[model samples]
Target: MKSVLAHPISQEMDSVAFEDVIVTFTWEERPLQGPSWRNPHKDVIQQILRNLSYIENQWRDQHIENQYKKILSDI
Candidate 1:
């Protein structure tokens, strides 16, 4: 399959502000206790935001290709 990072939508993601990204992530009703058995906590969500910050830094540095490579490799 083609890489999502290479998609046109990713270009729009690159333009979005960091604050907007955080707002988007936190806006939804994320249940503390899930439909699944595991209970998720605020810190888990916060950690995701932290990881996103790292990716955002790379995106801001215009290392788009390298970002894709890193993401794909992680998967």
Candidate 2:
């Protein structure tokens, strides 16, 4: 008997000017006690990166709008 598990981690950064952002993705490998166990860490990491990119874009758009609103309000 064996167990299979994979852990994926991701991070996103927003630019100070609210014009750009970056995303980082990584994974952690655990002990695999089964012969049939396959490491899907890479695929998981790729998917996480894709999702993070999408989220980052959305965040940048919202941030820009918010900044514009703030500037208008201040004026």
Candidate 3:
């Protein structure tokens, strides 16, 4: 995960192979909104990574919470 989080993410990722099939990803970004989201090089990598981590944590917590709720419901 560190390797994934280490680099900037705004650039196009193209595609990759899983095992039997291939998968692709394409992203076309608009303009960055806030001053903090801006990069002089016209890159939003850092902000993208930050947002990705935030969403990852949020979804992870939500998944765990749902699992707990399910277990509680079984009780």
Candidate 4:
């Protein structure tokens, strides 16, 4: 629902809605290489949408951990 990006070097973060994230996704099956457990052409966007909640949670956890470490280092 908020900024889903988490990077140590980025000082400014961009905010985006969950719906916006879903709406703005664009991809191509072509020009893709390597192997996978499933077909790469089958609804890649939908699969990512399904897993977005888990991905968001991981980002939130990582962001919190980073903030905590920053505070500890500042002390």
Candidate 5:
């Protein structure tokens, strides 16, 4: 599994990979926090996004290993 996060302003892609899968997450700065669902604080949103990316990376790593092991066991 491969995961990537793209920064629009910097136009760069931060990526991580595991086995044969890939995933991506991206973020953009928003003003006024328009809706209730939107975070009122930009810092809080940034932290949450970072945590989510980390979790996804860990999950993919474990998942890919499990899949590969299973495939080999079937042989």
Candidate 6:
């Protein structure tokens, strides 16, 4: 499905000077924290873990794709 951002500040530089930026954002109206993140329930903790794993896999895939493109361009 197609997706869109909820905020306009897409890049760090988009903010004005010395603006507090939200590094971790969500499309939902509220952040996904159902309870205390430090002592969250099992389900909340699992969601956090899943998000972390997804981010890691995305980073790995992007890194590999960039390397592949660089190699192809250099050839």
RMSD of each: 14.2, 12.7, 16.2, 14.3, 14.1, 11.2
Alpha-carbon local distance difference test for all models: 0.68, 0.70, 0.70, 0.72, 0.73, 0.75
Q: Candidate 3: minimum summed lDDT over ten consecutive residues — where?
A: 23-32
lDDT of 2 by residue, 24-44 (tens): 334434343333443465576
Better of 1 and 4 by lDDT: 4
> For model 1, what is the alpha-carbon lDDT of residue 9?
54
TM per prediction = 0.30, 0.44, 0.45, 0.37, 0.44, 0.47
Best by TM-score: 6
> Which whole-number lDDT from 0 to 100 does residue 62 have in model 4?
100
Q: Evaluated with lDDT, which candidate comes out highest?
A: 6
Q: Evaluate residue 56 in candidate 1 and report its C-alpha lDDT on the 0 to 100 scale.
A: 94
lDDT leaderboard ranking: 6, 5, 4, 2, 3, 1
Give the range where candidate 4 is weakest over 10 consecutive residues by summed lDDT: 22-31
Better of 4 and 6 by lDDT: 6
Tell me the tens digit of each residue's lDDT in model 6 across 1-75.
998779876456653553464244466934676556635556766997999999999999999999999999999
lDDT of 5: 0.73
C-alpha lDDT (0 to 100) for residue 45 of candidate 6: 64
* Whole-model lDDT, model 6: 0.75
- Evaluation by TM-score, superior candidate among 1 and 2: 2
Candidate 6 clash pair list: none
The lDDT of model 1 is 0.68
Question: Candidate 2, residue 1: CA error in Å?
Answer: 22
| Model 1 spans with C-alpha error above 4 angstroms | 1-40, 63-75
